[model samples]
Target: MNKITYGRQTISQDDIDEVVKALKSAAITQGEYVPAFENALKEYTGAKYAVAVSSGTAALHTVYAALGLKENDEIITCPNTFAATSNAALYLNAKPKFADINEENFLIDENKINKLITENTKIITPVHYAGLPCNMEEINRTAKSCNIKIVEDACHALGSSYNGSKIGNCIYSDGAVFSFHPVKHITTAEGGAVLTNDEEIYKKCLLFRSHGMEKVNFKHMPDSPTYHEMQFLGYNYRMTDIQAALGISQLKKIESFVKRRLEIADIYYNAFKGSSKIKMQKRYKDRLNSHHLFSVVFESNDLRDKVYYYLKENNIFTQIHYMPVNKHPYYENLGYNYKDTPLAYDFYRRELSLPVYPLLTDDEVYFVIEKINTVLKAL
Candidate 1:
């Protein structure tokens, strides 16, 4: 059998054809495909507005900027996420105060949030870790009481649902972000989007996605077609029309992709149910995970390392979802302590992501489960 990866894109011929059409169009950078893709995302996720960007990081940066995150302001978030979650705050010169995770679900423990709140706290950025929605209703309440804005770092949770609403619906957030990286639920090669119900936030995000320039609400000229104004500092974060076309095509298959991922997750759950050494993430009755990753914690860090290498030796490539963000050397240089969130640090040591993409066949899924069980039992 061929080597299996932790996750990968499942590109069909339809996706390729759409990309080809986009390339053949007159404007590849600024074209109709971009808006069409954004509209498609809006329809899928039920967001009133969507802004497509170059990558997930761009989505985070743009949304944070649009929400008025500024120097020295504090944003509370989880440490058990990709660096981009915290890094975006750093980009704005805003401090990121991390809350610990609920080890049961690998999500930000909403209970820890209020304790971290300070006068400087301006935004609460909850990361939907491993596609599992955080306790948003509680988090939203906390933020509302503090008069803080909520922006969901939902890069791992495109198809996930919370309280019977889609993850990107912005029901509990000022805006929610999604990534379209190749390994994500859908692929635009490298793209992302911000979804929001707030019109002002939506307008600001649109500006931030393209250098903070606007043609309509001009400060200088009124009706000049050649006149545009740079309202604020922004970045060249716009997604290409080609990527948008691919995103449009991929969006159509998202439900099927998420379904397959859940099926694989169930298979893994059943296979490891009786294992004494494996601990799976907890599922909540109100949350539906997109299954972007199928991660498990082992009895010990040593056992996790052994299994990771064993799988690699058997031509099955697994991955560590992340090291606690505060544990990174750069974050350490900034005096951020990993031990501040003990659960997150501990989670980092034992977590391993198995193959869980849509294209992974049932046979491949079983092969992975069989190998993992064999190694765990032998160890």
Candidate 2:
């Protein structure tokens, strides 16, 4: 029996060929492929611009820094997401206020956001959990009312659509971030990107990713083309050309990759639908999920743990989507505990992510479904 993890990357020979070609090139660190990948993402997402970075965390940090988020500012985000969504705000010493999740979809409830807003609120970061887009229409309306900027944590959503528009189009937000981890919809080893329609924000992100340095294309001083200057303090968060090469290749097949994931998800959706003991993420008719994670909420923590361990015992590894960011030890030390976010706490207790990836075999898929059904029946 082969071990099956929650998610895995599907890299083809073409992906390797691209990386090899990039490696043989003269410039690997900052080369043409970097821009190629950025342009591919920009075109794919319908965003006016895209900035590739070292990691999703780097992307978020770059955006937060570019936005000039600093102390005395507050960013409202859900607790039911990765820490980086809110940590980007804390990185600048700004406060990250938690908004509880919607019970049905485990997404940030737009209605809850108004209660958390204050005069100091600067932005609202919404995480598109499990590739299921949050209610961006409502979120956009809420943010616009208070003049708060929106930064979508779209780490799990790549080839997904919302309201007939692509996820990274910035249709309802100022900017959006995507991760290329092995488990996400696509893989560039360790890379991420920020997409935006605003040119000023796009330029800011570009500067922030590369040590705040900009090559002087000074048309006024044709005499000094080599002159470069640091605009401000920044970090080395640039993605390598080698990674970009893989990104470009992988992106070429993203629609197909996402299609496969959704196909696998449909198996789980049908298998578990109408079950009294289990509930899957609710799907919306307005959009398609990238299906990065097919998480199911068991009726109780005990049953969820039982099935989780049972699957592992049978060589089928699983994972938890997340423990609420607020309950993490570091945040708890900062006076954020389970009590701070009730909905997130309740949601986490019953959640477990099953194997969901573009490459999962049909036999393995059916085995997982059978085992889950067996476990639930036993309970």
Highest TM-score, which number?
1
TM-score of each predicted structure versus truth: 0.98, 0.97
Instruction: Put down candidate 1 lDDT per residue, 198-306, tens digits, no spaces.
Output: 9999999999988889878688766668888898887899999999999999999999999999999999999898678999999888999998999899999999998
Task: Give candidate 2's root-mean-square deviation (CA, Å).
Answer: 1.5
* Candidate 1 positional error at 14, Å: 0.6
Model 1 lDDT, full chain set? 0.93
- Per residue, candidate 2 scores C-alpha lDDT tens digits across 323-348 of 99989999989888777688789889
Q: Which pairs of residues collide in candidate 1? A: none
lDDT of each: 0.93, 0.91
Residue 232, candidate 2: alpha-carbon lDDT: 83
Q: Which portions of model 1 show Cα errors greater than 4 Å?
A: none
Determine which window of 10 residues in candidate 1 has minimal summed lDDT. Answer: 215-224
At residue 42, candidate 1 shows an lDDT of 95
Candidate 2, residue 296: the lDDT equals: 86
